[model samples]
Target chain A: MTHILLRHRDIPDINTLNVYKKNGGFAAFKKAVTKMKPAEVTEVVKNSGLRGRGGAGFPTGMKWAFIDKNNWPHYVVANADESEPGTFKDREIMEGNPFQFLEGVAIASYAIGANAAYVYLRGEFWELAAFLDEKIAEMEEAGYLGEDLFGTDYSLKIYTHLGAGAYICGEETALLESLEGKRGQPRVRPPFPPSYGLYGKPTIVNNVETLTNVPLILANGADWYKSMGTVDSAGVKIFSLSGRVRKPGNYELPFGTTFRQLIYEYGMGIQEGRPVKAIMPAGASSSLIAVDDKVLDTPMDYAAVRTLGADLGSASVIVLDDTVSMDWVVNKTIHFFKHESCGKCTTCREGNYWMRNLTERIHSGKGTGADVDLLLNVAKQMQGKCLCALGEFSTMAVVTGIERFPQDFKQAVRSNS
Target chain B: MSLEKKYPKEVKQLLAKYPPEHKRSAVMPLLYLAQREEGYITREAMQDIARILEITETEVASIVGFYTLYHDKKEGKYRMQVCTDLPCALRGADEFLDNLCANLGIKVGETTEDGLVTLESVMCLAACDRAPMFQTQGPRRHQVSRVHDRGPHHGIGRGVEEE
Candidate 1:
């Protein structure tokens, strides 16, 4: 099938403004602003059943509809902080097919009545941000942005915001805080970004991939999008295939595509033809799924992956082969969480610090079986107590690794014993 | 030179990106500008940015300390951050980092005698597909710096891709 999100693969110059304009770019933003009512745009999206691609899988249109109409000067922030482990699809989309993603940002701004939008890119994407800044300038020069866009009262100005190396900033509330020049930490719930965000105004924070889907949804209509993917997942998703594969890259596949097909067909199987050991479907946050034939054949949709006791979060599938031990895998992940824990929340901050030592001991063959059990216990203790998902997610690999891959832990403990 | 005096145009553009009332939003970018030439954020840059944004110096420092990219201490001209996160490690990123350190005649976090390069083991950079992948965060350059991810014997890919 031809790629929708990754049209750059088919057309080389789609990144340029002239070629992008020729290939039906910004039409959706224009149509929504000049012709359609904002509610109508929301209605179309609601009917299409498009969900946020940033792990939560929340309905996109419903999120737009939730914007407080009483809230003045509504804001739209694009979550381009693609810091999640094993996820590189957004980076490719921004670099290869930027116009579409920017247009999606534009359309989203119009639908939510936001006059100003910001693309919160990661700091490491220095060149990419400069590229988008140029594109924004191009749109402004072409009269797509600025005062009186399309000769209508509706005007829009899009800006790019760079995030420093903090993974918590990827969270919507934390992203808003980061944009406000504060320490990137998650805020208390009950008033999400749509109600109180980016300086206490109603703001809609959508993932770059989620916003990238907007222009097409507006141009092609709801049915065209809903026609693709499974009933639950209503559009194509970019599966970031990586690890121990011959051809590791982003595969823009429909949600119903099988993990087996992604790793075997698209990724060309494990490196050196080694047998597949496990799969981290959601990067480090995933509960390690034992890669059996049955699991491989399962569809890669959100609901399908959920049945396997793991999420399809961001669809960043990190394939693991037999050469890697599960104990060492958890150790690496625990270390990452420890390094990244923002220290804002006790559960995450202390939990990760505590787990890191146990994992280090076990992996280094300096701990008893009791250490593995203690690590799992510490992870469970922090599960529901974390202020945000990062802490809770820190334990998924630990709990699941100990329960599922007892042999690996047993070997680590026995070596030291 | 301070950020304002050195790059006035860049400073204005950064300030213009956020609202006049909410100029504090530009702190991250301003910090980036401060680090652009110096390779590390200077004390004067922090104070200047804090003043420009109507924020406190400590506020700017907190942001600098929170994020990894904004360094307070001066370091090498090139900071080659390797992705030794789980996925990258699975594809021999750890071994790649080790070999690069050996080749450079330095440890993982140490700088070379010439202060040309400093290799670091960082968390996942979302480039998991490209194992042993890294991003250089010092001077700007057009060429792609190559650091091969294959085991010790593959030979170093090439010099730092970005200047």
Candidate 2:
């Protein structure tokens, strides 16, 4: 099947403006700006049932409609900070099918009545940002961006902002703070970005992949998109397949594609034909899913994966084979979260630090069985206390690893007896 | 020597990205500009940026301290950050990093004797498929080097030569 999000795979040179235009790029944005009312655009998207691809799985159209109508000079900030551990799909989309993603940004801006938009890319993506800056300029020159877009009073200007390395900034509130030139730490939630964001104004913060789905939804009606993926997940998703796989790369498959198909078929089975032991369905943030035949055969979707006690977050399926152990895996994830905790909330900052120490001790075979129990207790304590999801995500691997793979931890820790 | 006198055009363009009232938002890109010359943000550059954005010097310094990319000390002309996170480590990124450090005769977070490259182990860079991959932050640009196909030695040699 031809790619919807990763369109560049099907058509080469799609990164070039002329080539993209030839293949029907920006037509959706043009149609939305010239003909449809902003409310109508939101209504279509609402019917389509597209969810944010940035792990949270929040409804996209509802988010756009939440923009405070009373507020003036609304803004749209694209969360291009694709810093998740096994996730590389957004980078590919931005680098390959950039025009499509940018057009999605344009359509989103029109729907939310945002006049200015910002694409917050992680600092590591410097080259990609420069590439996208050129794309934005091309859109401006072609009259798809800048003042009076498509000969309508609804004008839009999109800018690209670079974030210095901070994983916590991927959180929408923290992203807004970083975009405002403050330290990238998440804000207290009662007032989310829609009500108060980016300089205390109503802003719609959409993920790069989520925004990329907009133009296509606007061009082809809602039902066309709803028809593709499962009932719960109503569109194709780019599964970032990695770890212990022969073909570890981005696979843009429709939702409800079974894990067996993604891992064995597209991913070409585990590396060296090893039997699959586990799966980190959402990178390091996932609760490690113990892979039995039933788990492997399960359909990959937001709700379906939940039945297996995991979210198919961002669909970054990191396959783990028998060669790997859950103890070592938990250590790696704890280290990542510890380094990226942002020190905003005491719970996350201190919890990750302690978890890192415990995991290090456990993995290095320096800890007793009591240390394993203590680690699990600490992780469970930190589950719901964080100001943002980062802290909660930090505990997923720890709690799940200890509960599901007791033998791994039992072997990892030295016996006190 | 200062950012304003060194690159007036770049500074002006950075400030123009945000609104006049919120020019403080230009602090990040401005800090990047300031770091362009010395490979790290200097004391004077921070002051200059603080003045440019009308933010306090502590505000500017706090940003550099908080984010990993912005450095205060001048260690090397090129910062070679290797991702040894879980996904990359699965593909021998840890072994690759250890080998590269051995080849350079410097440990991770240590700069070469010639002050040319500083080696650092970073978290996942989102390029998990391309394991043993790294990004080089030079005085001018950040370039991601994928050495999955080629060995680490070859990729490191190619990276140092190109930069």
Candidate 3:
């Protein structure tokens, strides 16, 4: 039960240099620079099976490997824009254990042979960004960062970039656009960040939680790191539990920890002891899973959530009780995606607007069965056609709500009539 | 200072995006710069921006008027934007707004008569869980300077409270 990915949760004040160093922090960077090669570091991460915690569970090592070596002066951009509803794990890590996060960024940059790295944070994280800047300066003073780190030729300088309060910037490409001082919108894929990113240079973008695991991966070795969680999804994850929970906060557990243990044991069950109706396992963007015993017992991980028809995105588990309405939940989520839509792509821009109108009508009791069907069709059409996951993700709640909680919509429609 | 001289570098760089004959492509960045300097785009500033961009005053005005982020009128020293979207609203943003209005001694869409603060409701600010949050945009350390400058211009605006 030792913490792997989220070791800082157990260690006190890991944000401080002394506390962090005491807990075997930056030893990874020292070892990686002095002993291991860049490719070897990436191979360790790849072998450990660490995936991106930023909704898209992409392999971290594969993302680094994808960087076009032909493109010189490659960049590393950490997606710290944790704007997904019910997601606050990154915020906690950045605020509570900043040094570890910074060291992770440094290690990732070193592993990918990136001389410069940027942590693109949400605008609300202005304070966190400033704090991180101070931490980066501290790292520089400690000789863990900057040119000739630990007497090697590997030079890395980490910078913190702020997004202008756009959720779309959480998308890797969109993050690059914002970092380049443009509007926060997603660029077309196929030439992903690894090929062409900030300023059209090869870039590797990793999530905050994903990079935070790097220090441990190097400190403990691949097998030791992989031993904590399920086979496919190794290491501990910080599940940000919120909404109607008596003891709502972040709970660090190994991946594949059951939803029941998280909700009841960690979250202390519902606030008023109300029956748990549904669980949005991955924030507003996740499909609403009916909180039956089966789902409660289902382990919390990428593959486990897949069996329940959802992804363990960011592991932002929002527990909903019977008092909350599914229609209302869908309406809230729709409103968010609609407002945050950068309007760069035709489908997400127009489709989200259309879906919002339908969700509002349905939730307000003004919608009919045909309206519901049309909403579903619009969401379906919007899938696979978006320039980024924001567009594709906007559909999860809508599709799942209608499919799993039809009675709620029917009741809302009936009430309106 | 004139808008052209204030942002000559930015204007020139942005203008290079278009052909010399099509200097109008720099209109957006010009307006953005103007607003950044003056806090809000006035009619005269818009006219100057249009002149620099080689576009009509009406074109500049229309573009400035379109985006809600761009203010056509003079904003108060502090601009408070509260998110009124569903997530925030459900989380008692309305009550928080009422409390804010009462505390600030002004209603929504109205600036304090002394111009200390302009209050407006935004559609969303992207932070749902941190609901009932409002952003105060102005010089973070110039509250005294702003109050003293506007104290003689007008008295405080009317305070409306909903019971």
Candidate 4:
């Protein structure tokens, strides 16, 4: 299939505004602003079953519909803060096919009646941020952005905001806090972003990938997108294939593509053709799925992966071969979570601290079988208690690793003598 | 000299990006500018940023403390950050980091006698596809910043981020 989101793969130089406009770049956004009503633009997106690509598969259109209309001065913030370990698809999209993503951002702002939008990029992308700034300037010059866009009374301006290294800032609320020039930490729920966000205004915080889909959904009708993937999961997704794969990068496959296809056909099989041992489908946040024929053949969709006791959060498929030890893998991931735990809540901050110690001990042959159980217990304790998904997610691999790959722990714990 | 004086145009543009009332939003980028001269963030830079943004120096210092990129203390000429996160480690990033440190005759957190490189482990830089990869916090930012931690970005101005 031709690339929808990643047009750079299909069309070279789409990052340039001239090349993009020549290839129908901002046509949908222009159409929405010029011809369609703000609510009508939202209606078209609502009809399309585009879900949030930022881990949570919440329907994108429904999120836009939830925007509090009673509130004045709406805003839209693009989640370009792509910091999930093993997840790097968004970076390629922003770096290569930037205009499409920006076009999507512009469309969302028009739909939400937001005059201003911000792309919250991770600080490491300081260079990429500079590149995007130039692209934004080009769009503004081309009249796709800036005030009175497309001859409409409405005005839209986009800005790039760089976030200091905080994994927690990927969370919508935390992104909001970071944008407001404060420490990045997740706030409590109920007052979601659609209601209270970004200095307590009605804001629609969509992932860069999610917003990128808006232009396509508007250009090619909703059914065109919904017809591609499974009924429950519509549209194509960029599955970030990494680790032990012969070809490690992104595969823009429709949602129903099986794990077998992603690993073998797209990824070109495991590195050096070793037998696959386990898979972490959701980066560091996924439960270690002990791969078997059933799991391998399972379609890589939200519902299919969930049935196997793992959510396809962001589709960052980390393949593992028999040569790799699950215990060591857990230790690496635990270290990442430990360093990234926002410390806002005690459970995640302390629980990850405890798990990291246990994992280090177990990985180093200094722990006992009881210690493995205790690690699982610690992970369980941290679950359902974190202020955000990062805390609860830090436990997924630890708990699943111990449960599914028990032998790795037992061998590591056994006395060599 | 104050950071604003050294990079007047850059500081002015960054401050202009945000609202005049919301000048504090420029603090992070200004810190990036302030760190340009010294390898680490100096106390004076924080005060300069505070004065420019009208926020307290304590506020600017707290932000530096919160983010990993803005260093408080001085370090080697090059702060070579290797990502040994899950995916990177799966592709031999840990061994790569250890070997680089061993060759440099220093530990992960230690600097070489020449102060050319200081090895450190970062969570992730979102470049998992390129395993055994590390970002060099070059003194000149990106100019000298490469995988080996040399170039204009090798040992110069300040920068900032998480993976």
Highest lDDT scorer: 2
Worst 10 residues of 2 chain A by lDDT: A408-417
**Scored by CA lDDT, what does every candidate get?**
0.87, 0.89, 0.76, 0.86
Model 4 Cα lDDT, one tens digit per residue, A48-149:
889999999999889999999998778899998998888999999998899999989999998998998989998888878888999999888878887777
Question: RMSD, each candidate, Å?
Answer: 2.0, 1.4, 6.6, 3.4
The interface RMSD value for candidate 1 stands at 2.3
Model 3 chain A is weakest, by summed lDDT over 10 consecutive residues, at A1-10
User: Tens digit of lDDT per residue, candidate 1, span A1-417?
Assistant: 788899999988999999998989888888898899999999998998899999899999999999999978899999999988899999899989999999998888989999999999877777788788898899899988899989899989999988888888888888899999899999989798889988999999999999899889889999999999998899899999888889999999988999999999999988899989899998888889988999999998899999999999999899888877888999999998898888998889889998999999999999998898899899989988998898888999999888888998999889665
Question: Candidate 2, overall lDDT?
Answer: 0.89
What TM-score would every model get versus the actual structure?
Answer: 0.97, 0.98, 0.82, 0.95
Worst 10 residues of 1 chain A by lDDT: A121-130
| Model 4 misplaced stretches (Cα beyond 4 Å) | B141-163
Query: Candidate order by DockQ, highest to lowest?
Result: 2, 1, 4, 3
Chain A TM-score by candidate, in order: 0.99, 0.99, 0.96, 0.99
User: Which residue pairs in model 2 clash with each other?
Assistant: none
The positional error of residue B13 in candidate 3, measured at the CA in angstroms, is 19
Off by over 4 Å in 3: A1-9, A415-417, B1-76, B79-114, B117-138, B141-163
For candidate 1, what's the TM-score of chain A, rounded to 2 decimals? 0.99
Instruction: Give the clashing residue pairs of candidate 1, or none.
Output: B144-B161, B145-B160, B145-B161
lDDT agreement of model 4 with the native: 0.86
lDDT of 2 by residue, B1-163 (tens): 7788889899899889999999999999998887776778889988999998889999999999999998989898787888888888888888888788888889999988878889899988888888757877666544333323425574564566575
